[model samples]
Target: MKLLYTTLLVVVYIIPAINAAQCLSGQYPPKPERLLPTYVVNLDAPPVERWQDLASKYKVELKDLIAYLKTFLVEISPELQYLVDLVDTKLPAMADTLPAPYGDEMKGISQASGLPLGEVVLYNIFYEVSSLCTSIVGQDEKGNIFHGRNLDFGGLMGWDKINHTWALTEKLRPLMVQINYTKNGQVLFKTTTFLGYIGSLTGVKPGVFSVTINERNIVKGGYIGLIEWMYNINRNQSFITFAIRDMLTNSESYNQTVKYLAEVPLVAPCFYIVAGTKPGEGAIITRSRKGSDDVKLLGRDDLWFLAQTNYDNWKKQPFFDDRLTPCIKCMQEKGKNQVTFESLYNVLSSRPMFNKETVYTSIMEPATGRIEAYWQLCLDEEAPCRPW
Candidate 1:
């Protein structure tokens, strides 16, 4: 542990300086030779067995992911072990009680992966508390809306846990999956997420809208409150990420989707950015537990874009969410005229926006149902400080 702390200090301080000029220099790792395959989850299958197909196909990768998640459980166990351990056992039952298919899907993932249900449950909930992301929505000259984001997640301490060979983010790169949820014969919605998790932090309802979740800044008991809510599971309770998925599956129009997202009850606070297919269909919904704390939309006449980076849109100079200002500045420079898939991808992949913690970048267009999900890495050319 002492050695680990020392290494972390070196990573946080010394390495950033070594790579100061290169960090977020619009340099990205050579795109992976192949993207992870989309898992087609059939709703017709019993929820308990829905993930069996994925398990059969990606058994080895799933085992590797389980091993990776255990390191985090072990690392953070000192302070939260009692709670984590207790809830670990109750996860399967919690799944049974929650109205969503999460519990059953997790059970299916565990059963198919040949792993403990408790660990799988913990893995599903882990990122909800820790992920830091950037989401941007814009309208182009043609009136098509574009939505893009980078999903960044990793506990700084446990990042180098993979035999110290790769960061947890790197290990997660290959595990990225774009899940297409199929009902009877057609695709309902799609989420760019990890393989085992059933929730959607980044998803799109084709030709309708796209939505992304950025962890909200908490003044007080946000993380613990969410865990407590999960511990005492109720059918009445719904997680925001689960709510995002539900919205994608059910909501038909952009306006209807906005209303549902802004009004849904959540166990925690978060920022939901939605982009529609029309000219002025974009919004950033800053949410409290019960409903929206604030809803900022586009089309303040020439207001062509909105960028969110884990802070309430109303705050000035968010203390920890440093990415917000830079994000806005970059988008403004790109301008509304350049708001295409490729240009937005450029904005998201640039430095500051594209930092070491980013695991994957997602670009979506609801107009034509175009979704581009890619695993990300910062090469030494981009970030010498990249611990992975």
Candidate 2:
């Protein structure tokens, strides 16, 4: 009788454990229509010649895409047009806030892609200008910082979900570029970006840090607050991803990266996940559009593993609430093992939290200068969905 009773208790505990573990192996999503294109560009050369080279390589695609975006602007044309006009009047002052290299790069993009300077400016702030995404940061068993996300947005122009559909292979793939910037006297940085944009929406500079950004849900303040946000456009502050780009240029450690991200003034409310090369260094930072003083960080001290699925840490916004518990359980179990690059990949692959809208996925081991990424949402079709 005693033996049977003990057996029953063990079974009860083990069954739930098995069920939780199974969530990591959830159903594989169907393949995306096309794989995202990846390429490299060197901006170390003279700005005119360099951008002109890019223009020459992808001129046709860039031209068409710009037209597509302009069409989307038609839907919210009045508001966006007013904002663009505001930016145009303040262009010089706004450009001054960016590091000098960005100005050169933007000019190169504009010149090379045949995009107007004003259009180039709008493209640089795409994330803030566009709708949504989700970012997560966690440390592997080896303690390397890794961040993953699903970048969701209304399809470019009016292709209607075209970003995820394979049908966009020819048109969209050509515009996907992985820029490698290595000026003679500057830090080397690599970014996975669309052609003709000069910001780091997602990228890494090995030995510095791997970083990504997401937007905060606008606050539910009174009408007075909304009016104030509209009137208080500070073009002089660094836009979100551009701020991450600036940090990669100067910061050398995880702490320094966090500090820079915390102190920088930004044009919109944003979240940043920065994983450092050192153990216990990665962090998720939440800040109000109001700026630095509103900065709050959730780091290893708070939780050894953290994931941001388009929700602020404070309010625990519930977009993917169902996936959270299972993901947290899976990551914790994996952390107990010899966490390899594959381990990090598994966490993102896990269906409970791996968003269907994921357009790109990246895994980084900054300490060893190793990084791997798969884009265009095709990782599902691969037999063994491990890092490439």
Candidate 3:
């Protein structure tokens, strides 16, 4: 009887603990050549209906997707309570400030995904709240100005258990959602992003401009109060990437984009790369967490290449992101006067700069409004075998 009881305890508790340990400690497999397949979503219906259709279509992954995002937030935010505080307190006002169409869209995403409106709002601002990236905006030998970047965030950080398990269980794949807007009727504005997300990080407006952002830490600025933070949330009633989406939708030219980017309000300080089809229109717009008055702009009318890594080159401070030198050197040696789409691709995919954490790589030909993207470098199957 004693032996049986001991055996039962081992079977019920010890074995399960060992299994859980194995599952948690499991190594991630190489990313498949693609994360998610590409798909197009038209925002032509009422915001709720549009998001509802999107949610229903992707219902299988919605729960896991939220879990995957939560793991990252739990790892990054000061504490889960801070995020909860933001959602409980600031989210409503932030949502209220959104152009009605976008707010309705958020409601739709929340309703369809069965996620609380606060979670949806927090997820939409994830990058704004925390992110890491590097971007380049300079002209090739042929006067072709291109915008290129590698989005680097915490990938293999312990959040893997959630992603790996869910991915395996669901045969899950990543997706690039090409969003088309119907706000003013037949707008040329379009953005490509992950499925279940509703903001622009890297985007372009054909015949207008291309834009991307890099994070700027506000450690030196000290803590900001919630009331003060929300007050500075918008320049023309948009926040974070929604501002980018709005600009791409409404701005018709590079100058117009610069004006909007300059005037835009943000809850955080960040580095922006804006490239235009016209000569002398491309620039790096530096944003302050405070307001537009503190905003700064820099661009070159004459340069074979223009770029920004993680730090503020405009301030000429002693600080520079570790990746800056390698990126610049890569462009000069491999891309020099021979800078072509292929060369840009090579540089982004080259040593020092490229790594396991790189989620995606993209190059935009603003002059022609064309974009070439390679998703999942770790599992690079070279889906985009050719670059124009």
* RMSD vs true structure, all candidates: 3.6, 10.5, 10.7
Lowest-sum lDDT 10-residue window in model 3? 19-28
Q: 1-388 in candidate 1: lDDT tens per residue? A: 8467747656663455432421122333335654556778888889888988786576677677767666565463354454466555666565675666778888888888886777777677665556678899988887788999988776453645433323667667767888988988888888898887778889888888899999886664245545666567433456778888888888889999899889977777888999998889999999887788899998865688988887777778543336677678778787777887777777777666666678788989987777878877654453443331
TM-score leaderboard ranking: 1, 3, 2
Q: In model 3, state the lDDT of residue 169.
A: 16
In candidate 1, which residue ranges exceed 4 Å CA deviation? 1-34, 74-79, 161-166, 230-235, 318-321, 383-388
TM-score of each: 0.87, 0.73, 0.75
Residue 328 displacement in candidate 3 (angstroms): 0.5
lDDT of each: 0.73, 0.56, 0.59
lDDT, candidate 2, 185-214, per-residue tens: 543766666677666777777787788776
- Candidate 1 pairs with clashing backbones: 24-351, 95-103
Worst 10-residue lDDT window, candidate 2: 379-388
Q: Residue 75 of candidate 2: its Cα lDDT?
A: 44
- Say which candidate scores most in TM-score: 1
Better lDDT candidate (1, 3): 1
Per-residue alpha-carbon lDDT of candidate 3 for residues 1-388, written as tens digits (9 for 90 to 100): 4345435534643343321211011112224454334444455666667667766677557656556666545544344446556765677566666666677778887788787777677666666655567687767555667788776655322323333211211222354454554453654655556666777888878777999877765563212323344566334333567678777767878888887777765655677778888655577777775454333333333456766765665545222124565667767675546556566666666533454356667778887777766664432242211100
Candidate 2 global TM-score:
0.73
